[model samples]
Target chain A: MADAVIAAIPPGRHARLIVPRLLQRGEDFTARLLIQHPMETGFRRDDTGKVLPANVIENVVLLFNDELVFRGRVLNALSANPSLSVQLTAQKSGTLSAHWRDQMGNVGSISTEVRVAGA
Target chain B: MPKHAQRRTLLGAVAAAPWWWAAFVGTASAQSSTAGSDALDERVRAAVLVRGGLSLDIPVIVETGTSVPIVLFADPSQLRPGVRVTRLGIIAPKNPRPVALDMELGALMSQARIATNIRLGASQSVTGVALLSDGTVWQQSIAVVLTGSACYDGT
Candidate 1:
């Protein structure tokens, strides 16, 4: 049964963080994040018509320089492997972290180091 | 100004802030009623009553698919002083489940602008609501005409 659940999710980069490697100080840049998950709503039935338990990512948090920049509580309506895009302004170089927590308590995180163009 | 009068004036201003805000943006609050209306309207009214001052950025017409991007945001730049948005919700009434998304904003993340994709079950209104830290609410909505319905999982 555990293997079946694991099989539902593909193996690859379960999480991806997209941020500009270099940016001008005080400039706003777009940061996008993609996480690979089945986002199973638990309402779908298996091949035998048995209902699968709901398992969806419920929490997402983004941090820059250890500061909470974004937090989201996602619902099942989001498509599988959800992607989030938001605007963020940084005045200094720092690390951006993307963290995801699913309903099953599974956690994943990714971080990227960013630098200011001339700073 | 006498000290007692100054204190009274300050208290008066503090007491009137929330009411003033609710009255200033009257549209959402005025239309907010979760009575014996239909399922969709009830959800919209409930969301609106929860909070207001939210806006949905999406096209009026959309091609239904597994992924239809929608943007919901609250601009704190023009907000009244001391107004802080603490939570946001995205409601798609026509879907099998109405609440598409709900977000909690931290102190440093009070200003929210989220870009996410939603699956529309049918042509319907998508609603967004923002709950202020001071117990005030604001809401915004957008109607999308879907050409087709997305596949549901029997939810």
Candidate 2:
């Protein structure tokens, strides 16, 4: 009866995933994914001086046609909306799935398809 | 000695004698709970940053925390055609923890320009790194000062 509310992670904006609509095989492919999250390092405090909970998507997994490929872990050094780019062999056309989970049980998912058939 | 304990001991040590070790096992692991953070530094260096390349150090040390700036400019002549920088990250040697930032730089559409805020854990030398079209890594470092820490309180 209620829609799922996607609240801000805290310090982070929110999560976003980007990728090319089509990629040519035999050439380097760039896959981009951005995550908008509070990415709290569990270090800062609120106006009331409360140590915010450490909430960040610590792990990211990329699946090409259900095959594990690119994965990343968020560290304290990353900016607000974390981004990822990886070089993948454009061998075949398939579905690209990206999943990220934070320490606070928050999850983000994105998927894209590839057309590696010639140009 | 128990069977499991004896076998485990033998596997852990070359001669069953502990010389020394860190809590997290490897140097990177010990420095930061996250693995693959240290090697990411060396990898990015080999992939993008180079000499002849202009290095830009992002200077912003706030407790609120954001990705610091560190950019590299390489001669387009040196880059292979259609080679886009897939990701850029920052590496620190003395931050008491690994600080890594990742971003998808639109290579095909835009010129090489990566400028953004980065999260700093502490005062230390931060290296900017990038990954190019061929999976090669390139990086350059800049020293920064931190009034407060973001990772753990080593101050």
Candidate 3:
């Protein structure tokens, strides 16, 4: 993973969402997401001996077809390059979207479509 | 004293040592567990918490503390029928912030199974708590040993 390249990307562009493209109604499936971040804790110092400010994702929300499904509040205790997985039931064919905001006021979002058959 | 009498005294003392050790260590751990739960209670704002409804899956021994993968599962058998889990949280009592991750599960969730990674400052027991729609709270803790300390020193 190139840290420089990831940093250069605009906020929310570094987010990755992985979900099954096809699904059967009423079946349980897992949706995984990863957001690239340094997750600074403010206790760390840079090479020049200056203390680094804490910068981490503060809020994360996941929605399916505009219906809220999950929301998360992350603290500095989470590891860098935070990733999360949750089990969701296939209801109707719709969009699965993830949005997050960092401590520094940077926001990012990503979405994927899942088709549910027999719905 | 007779030789047999002296031998009997030595054997009795040896047999009692384990019980003594257990009593001493048991009290220490019990106190720590209480403190851990108290911290969690404050974070979740719940008065009473029932243990054993949730399970935490993590390595007993981790080579590094930077990224420790953990999975939390809600036991349906332990929960009341028709009561859904509304929230799930991970608490690291020894870390700077006790609440590592707090998540709200909506109606779309079929089950409460969540996976994530966390940072530990040292070897300590981490707690996982779940809140049910019926206003009941459940929690479970797991001890982890970290050979390499993380999050304490400046990054």
Candidate 4:
């Protein structure tokens, strides 16, 4: 039986990070990336008598042909998983990069090499 | 004032700093709740700034918090040469802690998409706060409903 890895983020809870690679033709490609960030509502508390700190992933970016494409910031009002679907124009495939940044100045960047066999 | 008085003043100043901050946070939270029914305070909100364009909230309707999926529309191509979404935050009135999760947006393009999981507290309104490079702020909000739902996560 083939093995499958499941990446799931708890409901109402935020994610830590996510990286996705989009592959199309031999020379063209699209990279879909995302991170898990709990849209902290700043309400609940732990065992201690103090309130818990808020944490969530916010920013995102997509690169194609070493150029920039989709870009936007995530707000506190968003739900759990930041579902993003961007359109990337592929030309002379070099490398497609997907990057995600959170509120705490943390960043996660992943890249996929492009290989176009057919002209 | 006498030397002893000066010392006492210094001690008082040092001692009441956290208290003042706490008080300020409390009052601000209270005021925000009062001023805008759904508005959270700056302290509780963990207010952060972003670079270039701000990433406000991602206004949308959520059925539950367990498997929440968010969507955005800002054109990443318009962003300057080097910029990234650094942080994301969300807060609600019913949940225990105001924060849900935090992560890093590594060195990548501005046009990217993502999806994740989340835990919810009853049916309440949620907010999304995304921070960017160079210290700027963007935000989004959404309302969630939990019909016939019970808090059963025994973790």
TM-score of 1: 0.70
Model 3 has fnat of 0.73
For candidate 4, the per-residue lDDT at A67 reads: 64
Best by TM-score: 3
Top model number, lDDT: 3
As a whole number from 0 to 100, the lDDT of residue B64 in candidate 2 is 37
In angstroms, how far off is A96's CA in candidate 1?
A: 1.1
Off by over 4 Å in 4: A1-119, B1-63, B72-82, B110-112, B148-150, B153-155
Candidate 1 per-residue lDDT, tens place, A1-119, comes to 99998787643237888988789988878788888887776656777788777777877888888887767754658877888777777677888898877888888899988788776
- Report clashes for each candidate as comma-separated counts: 8, 28, 2, 105
lDDT of 2 by residue, B25-134 (tens): 23334335665756644432333225334354566444433455444443456567767555555556554346454444433323344444556766776666555667
lDDT of 3 by residue, B4-101 (tens): 99999988755533222222223324445664645543433433467757999999899888899999889878777788888788877777766677
Off by over 4 Å in 2: A1-14, B1-65, B69-90, B93-96, B99-117, B121-123, B127-140, B144-155
lDDT of 3 by residue, A1-119 (tens): 69997667754458788988789888889999898887887777887878888888888899998887888754457788888898888878889999888888889999998889977
TM-score of 4: 0.40
Better of 1 and 2 by DockQ: 1
1 against 4, candidate with superior TM-score: 1
What TM-score would every model get versus the actual structure?
0.70, 0.53, 0.79, 0.40
Q: After superposition, how far is residue A109 of candidate 4 from its true place, in Å?
A: 16
Give the Cα RMSD of candidate 3: 10.4
Q: How close is candidate 2 to the true structure, as a TM-score?
A: 0.53
2 or 4: which has the higher TM-score?
A: 2
